[model samples]
Target chain A: MLGRLNHIAIAVPDLAAASATYRNTLGTRPTAPQVLPEHGVTVVFIDVGNTKIELLEPLGADSPIAAFLAKNPSGGMHHVCYEVANIIAARDHLKSEGARILGDGEPKIGAHGKPVLFLHPKDFNGTLIELEQE
Target chain B: MLGRLNHIAIAVPDLAAASATYRNTLGTRPTAPQVLPEHGVTVVFIDVGNTKIELLEPLGADSPIAAFLAKNPSGGMHHVCYEVANIIAARDHLKSEGARILGDGEPKIGAHGKPVLFLHPKDFNGTLIELEQE
Candidate 1:
């Protein structure tokens, strides 16, 4: 099951520009950019204390964000991450209920260095959902 | 600045089926459906303790979700609602930052019975953002 809303991730064509919007306009300073080579994304977290806004940019040509940007020249909300107490248990439960998990059905080390699994967008009403073990 | 993420909304084709997924599959109970004729949406909230998952279904043929579903048959994540301390201040700040607020450039009473405004998808990288005054 899902816990609290961890963060909502936006796929941006330009991370710096997006970060500047938060910093200069929204008055929220974003965290330093962290590149996740495995995911092919460079992410920056805008902390709002209770939750965070994650800005994601394509790290490489093969990155998923790059493909997403190709379809949507601008950027868009990519996924919403929810915290779960136990990811394996959550994954198993979702699988049992016929919800599809992405990426070989295995949990991968995520941006927070915690185990994370992505649920298929189709199963979640076209919203790519990510479950991070807290 | 944004406070806690109040809820993330998902547009679904079938409110009952989607509610069943959360209630039976995900093990989360959803609240009763609330119809907002003004917004043309029928919504149900799934409490996650810290936040909620708002499931939206089209109230009529002209509902925005109807158009969204026409493009995306299975439904998808529509928009995310963030909580702000002051709606007017937040709207002004976002406007000054070059964000386009949807509607008549004013806050409208939202589903929560609070002043709410929607930021254009273009300004927020194609993500429809809703700011609700807490």
Candidate 2:
């Protein structure tokens, strides 16, 4: 069901500093920060050949990553996304396997404009997993 | 410079259960666990097309991930490994940029049998970064 590893999302307290670290220290060119009001994050994508590293900063008080930043002030790996051929089928299979889907168990338009659903971290070795339809 | 992401390492408290979750729930085949005593880890690799997800369980009392698991009982993203053309040069460049290299600041043989060095999380947005010579 899983295809390519889509991207690894890192929630950072300071987006510019994180982006600069990747750009200057790691020598990777990071895209300009783009604010996603719906997702409540300002994201910058760093292409690392096969996959991407997404630097996310909370956009507002109700931002999804605001709590994560509070818990991890310096920032941390937030989630890993995997591409899937058919998200509905994948979700169904995961449900049948006793895997817990996050939210209302419905796929939402993700940061990449793709249908995506998050799985419970406890059900996934404490890793927040995002399944994106490719 | 950073190349392809070598793998995303997730430290799991229960290796078998984590492997089963990836294999069954995610519908991805996981390689059999391989114990690396030198690294103090038992690892299973889940191929996600472009890169791999490395599931690491502590091998002994002094395992590097033991402390991480102690803090996160359920486990969590331990580190992100990125390939480098020349590790020594990468280390030198990172140092020039004031990035703190972990441990003795020398590249050591990583789980994949490649020379690798870990950068301080505080220097990289609180994300442990591994640079592997490829």
Top candidate on DockQ is: 2
Model 1 scores a TM of 0.94
Off by over 4 Å in 2: none
Candidate 2 is graded, for docking, as high
Looking at candidate 2, what is the lDDT of residue B103? 92
| lDDT accuracy of residue A66 in candidate 2 | 88
lDDT of 1 by residue, A1-134 (tens): 77888898999988998888778766677988998888899999987777888999999778977877888778888888889999999999999999999979999898888999998888777888889999
What lDDT, from 0 to 1, does candidate 2 have? 0.93
* Model 1 bad stretches (over 4 Å): none
Model 2, range A1-134, lDDT digits (tens) per residue? 88999999999988898888889989999999999999999999999999999999999889998888888899999999999999999999999999899999999999889999999999877899999999
lDDT, model 1, position B63? 90
Tens digits of per-residue lDDT for model 2 on B1-134? 99999999999999999988888888899999999998899999988899999999999889999999999999999999999999999999999999899999999998888899999999888899999999
**Alpha carbon lDDT of each predicted model:** 0.86, 0.93
